[model samples]
Target: MDTQLLLLLLLAMVLMASVAQRFPENSCAQYFQYVQSGIGSFQGELTLGLQNGRNRIDVRFSQLGAHDQSVVGALLPYPDEVTVRASLRAAKFRVSLWADASAVLPKLTRLVYNNNELCRASEYNPQSFFNRFFELHINGPQSPHRVAPTPVIHKFPEGQTDVQIKTVVFDGSERSISHILSDFVNEQTATSAADWAPKSPAITSISSSAVPRQRWPTSSVPTISSIAPAPWKPATPASPFIPNGIRASPPSSVPWPSFVCGQEGTGVPYIQRGMEFPRGRYPWLTAVYHKESFSLAFKCGGSLVSTSLVITAAHCVYKIREDRVLVALGRYDLDNYSEDGAEMRDARRIVMHPEYSSRLQLQPDADIALITLDSPVIFNDIISPICLWETAETETEAEIGSIAGWGTDENGNSMTRYPRVVDAKIATVGECARRWKVQKILDRTLCAGNLDGSGPCLGDSGGGLMIKRNNRWLLRGVVSLGERSTVDHCNNNQYVLYCDLAKHMTWIRQYIS
Candidate 1:
């Protein structure tokens, strides 16, 4: 062989031995060149990678404990910089070379020729001084690193102390070191070293294949305090009227009515009318009505369509004595009968809305009536008449409507007697139709209620169903039978029907005229 070639071969062999002596038996050594110098120290768990001319490292750390915590990142690697990450807890470390071949070759050549040669010449003996010297040069110091022992003190009753020594290494890994330290502390106590060791507290074993068993301590059994017996009490008697075995009276806060409308008959519509004036325009709108019964009594509410023509529920005038029927105009105050106010007129004749039927078994949507007063009601601030029904050009549910008369609130309790009016928005025909399922809510008569729980109730029967037409209120429906029952109150259930006036508009106009 040539002299120069032999020298090269000998140099390679020596270099291999030097490399073997420096690293651990399975250590991976690779030359890495940083694209840029002066990278700051980073402390976090991370993954390292190289892309383009930049070294990228993703660092992760919990900002808080297991719960209620967040993680934030900072200072991503820029171009031409190498990245390395070390995780002491997980025992992981990574490095990425980010420079070109020209920048990395010099470091690789020096390490291979010098370090490898020394390791091979030393026969891979790490303990040898010659091998150690080369190992230190190539890597760093190999002295057994020492850390101060951490003393743990656990306090028991009567000031008894349990002291333990804990050691943690910082060679980029701490999990295994921590576990070993814990085991040493637990087993090293004087009490645990006895030949007949005292059994530990009961520990419930949890296993998938076997039923868990509770292990009890053999040394001592804990004492438990005895509890006293509870005192006996007598039970109260319950009322028969209330169901569910409850005898409690209804809440006093809500005043229940003495008489519920339609309790004796099919039902009564709860009519609601809008305020005659806007807010602050008529302060009296907020005034509560006092109850007063007219000498001549009728079972229904009526609308003064004409000076003499009064439209109402037919059932109100059915089989009623003429003397008992009185037209109470401006009868807003129901409480005081003697209070000086507009006097009511007696009806000369009663004309039911021609379509109004006493024979038709009352369902929910159809009962209606009309009465002709003996004298015309003089329209005044106190005795204003509502508009008569006109053929509805647009009878959609969205068309705003109102119902007005004396009726009860949701609890079947009457709010007023003579004429208390409340108003509610009309529901869409599609919604009302689907709700009531009665084919009756159509073009002529519309349905109202839903929002604010507005609808006709007891005593509102024969009252006026009015709609807002060009900003004017027009009579659209008559208060008829309601679907009696708390469950159907306020026309809440789509099945409960109210009177539909449009169906009898032609008959109403002909008779009233």
Candidate 2:
């Protein structure tokens, strides 16, 4: 072989190798990386990977030693991250996608950014966008991560409702919740909940399953990870439960504070004039217990927000320092706590709404509070988290709602033994204001009861005035102040006041997350 020819051939081979290196092996696996030192101490990688009309993104933190919450990254220069997030609000952001996919791929229809179909818009309908959507997989969502949950209730042009529950049966043990509820229903007779069972949103009506299996083009269902991510949107992904601008999404499992929604039925004995809840009628119903050095007494009522959370009133837990506070769930009868499903756990932390100044007495405004249990409780039918009302429908069907507690009875006696649940009608705030004085009926307060003297009494403070819908019970309000004339005595004639739960979701979820 000629020496010159051999040298030319070697040079050509080397050039070809360089060209091969320049081009990627898998065209679809191309990605763009952004190193965000993050707001405050949060330093993470925001990445986007692209494939055929699909996108997968991961916003992950670069673990630089352990995070020191005390570290003030502010006070320094640009290289050092800020300790506070105030700057984030004023800054205009820019997201850079490295590939030519945006310009080249115009027919892009489907998107799986952080496992959500972010962009449903095509070229003609390019108006939808979800802003500030990012998913960081830190320890498989066990720790804190963004999970956007869609709203359960929405007004539709077609007059239909979109529920977000996944129809596919992914787990053998995971049967339809309706079936579990139905099974619980058939076991016995009589309930304090409303008579109507919750109607399941038509399976076909569920709007957020990333396009049903039948709707897809006949080929293969694409795994979300295989696709590159798309731009953020202001709209949440379709869902059966509404996070309602709460989080990017809810946890994979049922979101925290998942109480039963809209349940009311008849069949029981008594709480005062209130009927006794069937063995475990109100699963989320709990008693906030103040555990003293030698004794434990449940003086106020609460509702379980999650496996590790409870919701009560500020007045119930604010200053009763005589005992360490604890939360008890699923206790049927105070006399017979040996009743099944009742579990007690110390409150690890309590977050009273910052404005809630209720001390020994029930304040009409800002009476709400949240209690973080030391550990997550094992949830059962009798012990579980209840859902909060997404919308405040003060006037429920027939203007009816119910309150359950160990208040005084019709005989003008205190509710010392068997507690009862009873029905009450929603009352106008204006009337309540007139009855109590302008300053008494606060904006956060709601009044409900019967004219015939069928309402909450003493010892019912901090209890919930619940409303039933769709077979689940939603916490509508926390018992704040009873009519002063009837505070010490049992009187259905005077309307009872409650701190509206529906109005204070923003303040509640802030600490819950």
Candidate 3:
């Protein structure tokens, strides 16, 4: 009898050990840290602690009016085995597995309440608790949700009161960081596809038949071996991107060295109802082309940033034959053969951001690219490079910037002899969300244009939105895609979205440096 009792006790201990292994004691803490780190600087009145060996997060939703069943029911009916309990101001969610919890995040939005999605990420307002929780659980800290998140908390269009999550807790395993990031990517792709239509006016290249035929034999193109590259020098105060780095001082204190880049030519500016760019007003402007049957045809616009590097939209270069890519610098009048200062060079290499995708369900995160020319561009007064934007604060201070391209004219016609530049005001995230009807805008992209139809149009994709500071033109944004309200022309009534250059400093520096 004694031997049997000892054996039974041993068996009981083994069973308890197995259960403990499956549900570790520190699982909740691990999950909390991962979420907290992801939340980054958006930490509001969110607190994390352990309750009965389960991780609990305490969040207060002062904006919800009242923490009642209405709020709880919208978050229901729970994802399978997850358990949740709510009080007046606090809630506790015991998640057996974080993976199962992924499906619950979207239901937190107003869409679950049967309201039309007035804007994407309606729940991601920092003023509300759900926004922090969602960001914490979805996007990682370094990868911000939006560059400048909207501060306005929109009310439901309908009479129904919106429920905002104040405080909540998640208890789960330590192996959640990787899973969470994976979910973020997947969700971003799906949400992007749903928000922005693939048929949007991404490519502005006019068909070859529209333009006069120009013969360019393959043998006449410059090869990498035949061209000698000049020694390119880096500009002053070499350092990584500073968020508001140059905001404290005036532009004079941090003057960009014009010897290398950011120098405008002595071309007279002409402004009418539509702005017309003179021969050398915007010198950095470049025209990217693709080889057709026996002649080169205009494809996209680009900004020459260095001796051999040109920046443009990724969609312009993606999946195209490398040898067929050509760039023409110092070109002003496309139809005028008498125009001087134009030099065409074959593209040596094209580098598109790895994250760039046109998949049905993918985020338009990295719609930028860098092209290396076969030969170093001989910079002239009419063909110098432009400076990459150094500070994010400059954008806000300027408010409005200039965009130039030989896109559709005011009448939505084909390419004209000369390009035009117009002033476009920066738009807010909330405004863009409503205008574009998107759920989320990547931090690496921004929206700007005029409601009167004075923004980028067909043939403008890959062009630069430039801002003048201290008498120098700086590249701020790239023309990505414009609202296609009409069939063949850009919807001048809506705003055009541009890839934010400020957000990709690290990636840009890697190649330029």
Candidate 4:
């Protein structure tokens, strides 16, 4: 496997241990926003984007980690996905999504395995799948429920679409599926016999030809009209489902881990999986270094958006007590400037947003700034400028973007000597309002980060939140001030504010040309 995939597996293993309490809630949920926005019953399988971050863990049988797992009540783990197909055996449990908990409950019949009943939800609690809420049941192997069914595969007939699914009764109480041979069965007689089973929560069973027909149940079996229902309708126990990968492995005895993004406010959490960025992938990420500190320290980030312009936060230059602030780019290792091919330039002129005063910068449009380089930058595969976002529609389809920088934590600490890249997802204005307590998030302001605990750290104050469009990266937002929740050097869970470059393109064009 590739290094990234191997690293991803390792990180997933680690997250398996600690994600319950520390995983960022809603960090990777953009893909499911449409489901939350739409009304009515929703049934289907979706691979929600919980990427990079350690994933949904089965907490039913293991140790708990740092995330907010307690709130995962209703959406616990249910057998909603066990569609009543031709081969469903009696005693297995499975998990599936249901828009309305109450509506699906009446349909859940007891699951019987090895002559023992399993997974009959004894209790339930509500959970938020996104903006909408859901619930799962309290289930386990040791509960009043029975043992896990040991699956034993048997050869069944396939030619000409003839298959016999039979349920056998043993000792007058227990039931089990007896998969009989299907090759020689006749159609008309089999159809007449199938009329004995229930239409919904259907169970298919065919007795041996030697058994008397009087053994069949006389209950009416309803047949669905030949007409197909709308494609997205919720799956009934009687409906067939397009196969999916979710919950199909490791058997069905374990409880699912929570997906909430709650974590302790320790140093910003590490990147979802702490995967290092490939060299030269993000050439525009620049380090804005200060001279007076002499620690050779840089606490802010900037983007080489044009040949002669390095865009950053106004507060970055305003707070610099020193006269010199150097812009360095085109290399990974920040400590060794002579490493391979790197470039450093002096700021020829500093231009702050007209409304950007240092005192008020923490509040509004006062956060953006630009630096004019003394010389034009030489473009290369390793160092290039990004495109500006210019579109009639301000809204973008992208929900997540990456931020790059050479920055560290609250105490000026760093895990890597090289500049690093991390992902941040765009959050709603309401989320920004909650994160930034002191100032309101204006229409021109933007917020992003779960960072999987990676950044928007102190040193990345002026970095760019870049979205890839067409085939090039576009500048969307510029790093600005933190709401009090994330002013620390590294913020893992809270959203960070940015000055929306999409709203300031006219001003940027005026200064750049």
**Residue lDDT tens for model 4, 116-162:** 22222211222111111121122222233222444432221322111
lDDT of each: 0.34, 0.45, 0.49, 0.43
Q: Please identify which of the two predictions, 1 or 2, would achieve the higher lDDT against the true structure.
A: 2
Q: Looking at model 3, which ten-residue stretch has the lowest summed lDDT? A: 184-193
Which residue segments of model 1 deviate by more than 4 Å?
1-298, 359-366, 415-419, 428-430, 437-445, 487-498
| Span of ten consecutive residues with least summed lDDT in model 4 | 258-267
Candidate 4's C-alpha runs over 4 A off are 1-274, 293-295, 319-323, 360-364, 396-398, 409-415, 437-439, 451-454, 483-489
What would the per-residue lDDT of candidate 1 be over residues 29-132, giving only the tens digit for each residue? 22222221223211121222211211111111111111111111111212111111121111122122122122211111111111121111111112111000
Q: How many residue pairs clash in each candidate?
A: 35, 49, 8, 23
TM-score of every candidate relative to the true structure:
0.40, 0.50, 0.49, 0.44
Give the C-alpha miss distance for residue 501 in model 1, angstroms.
Answer: 3.7
Q: Which candidate comes out best when scored by lDDT?
A: 3
Best by TM-score: 2
lDDT of 2 by residue, 140-250 (tens): 112122233232321123322221111111111212222122112101211111111112222211323322111111111111121222322226522223221122345
> What ranking emerges by lDDT with the best candidate at the front?
3, 2, 4, 1
Q: Relative to the unseen true structure, what is the C-alpha lDDT of residue 106 in candidate 4, on a scale of 0 to 100? A: 14
